[model samples]
Target: MTKSDPNRILRRLPLAVGGLGAVLLLINRLLTPELTESQARGDVVGVILSAVLILTGLIWQQVQPRSPDIVELIGEEGFVLAQDLPEAVKTELAWASHLLLTNTVTRSLIVYYQGKILLRRGILAAKAEVTPGPILKRVLETQKPIYLVALYVYPGRIEFDYLPENTQGVVCQPIGNQGVLILGANAPRSYTKQDEKWIAGIADKLAVTLQE
Candidate 1:
């Protein structure tokens, strides 16, 4: 159930309905002796043109690539509930970053437990220690997500100093007391409140899954 799946279905639905209606109209016009041959031909031509355009649009949409969100991945790539903790965490890190369309250089996930990094993924550099700095600390203390639209715009921010040089935006969400999930992107204002909500939901799921 990726985003494209619904889009593809919706795109074809209108075409199906419109084609049926056009067929019915063509049948009625064909039966009507009052319709001139030229008029009938015009109607057929219009229907054919419309159908071809609709089909072409559908094909174009099908060919376009779409990123999948968490919900879609959960349905299409199951076993989130069955996999062990480590596997599930890795799967989630990959899925969350992919769904958010984070830049590869900036995308990262750091799992912290008892004031130390337990796992790291997608980070650009290898540092001696990965601490939950001010931004992450805020997320953990508030038990809420934090989204920095443009890290560079905010001078002296801890994240701007620590994140990859190309990072422009970041989203941080606490995974219970177990860890925090961090997603960074190369474009300013890359994440919205809606994105924060989705990330928070994933963090919560990860926290619960780890506990189980």
Candidate 2:
């Protein structure tokens, strides 16, 4: 069975029990009449149990946990590359960015080198400037990548004005000591471990190409 099968089963269990209880109640009436006080009390108890089960089933279905709906963000779709970049570097940037947008959960990306915004691709925000916030600074200083799962929960998200403001997740992959690869996803907790590793590989490649 699939992962959702368990939830489906749990969801149907109460209804099933209610249905069985209701059927048994009807069957009991045909089998025997509740003429005695004890028999009538037992009948009332069965009716109460059936009602509770049915009510619980209806409530559980409404409150069942489901996947979060990621709203489609409003943004411009394009890439802005700084002029004077070498043709080889530009090609490498384009190829890598394309791969990321197509293959991963990334909905937006920015490539920063030294103090310049070398590339801004995919769904871009209205702003054109990007100042390295504490998170970005930390990544560059320690040369360690940071994955911000569910970007909406982080205060540092305010610094990423260059990416779409409603971006659900982000990956800040440091490129050597002077550059960083910023990837924004369409959904929270969307990127897998393998995706992060592949992104690091691409960032390394960009570092080599940009420096050359």
For model 2, how many clashes? 0
Which stretches in model 1 have alpha-carbon errors above 4 Å? 1-106, 159-162
- Compared with the true structure, all predictions reach lDDT values of 0.59, 0.88
Residue 123, candidate 1: C-alpha displacement in angstroms: 5.0
Model 1 vs. true fold: TM? 0.50
lDDT of 2 by residue, 48-135 (tens): 9998998988888877556545767669899889888988888999999999998888989999989899999999899988898999
Candidate 2 minimal-lDDT segment of 10 residues: 1-10
Global Cα lDDT for candidate 1? 0.59
Cα displacement (Å) at residue 147, model 2: 0.7
Model 1 Cα lDDT, one tens digit per residue, 93-127: 55654554442323554555446554444544334
State the local distance difference test value for candidate 2: 0.88
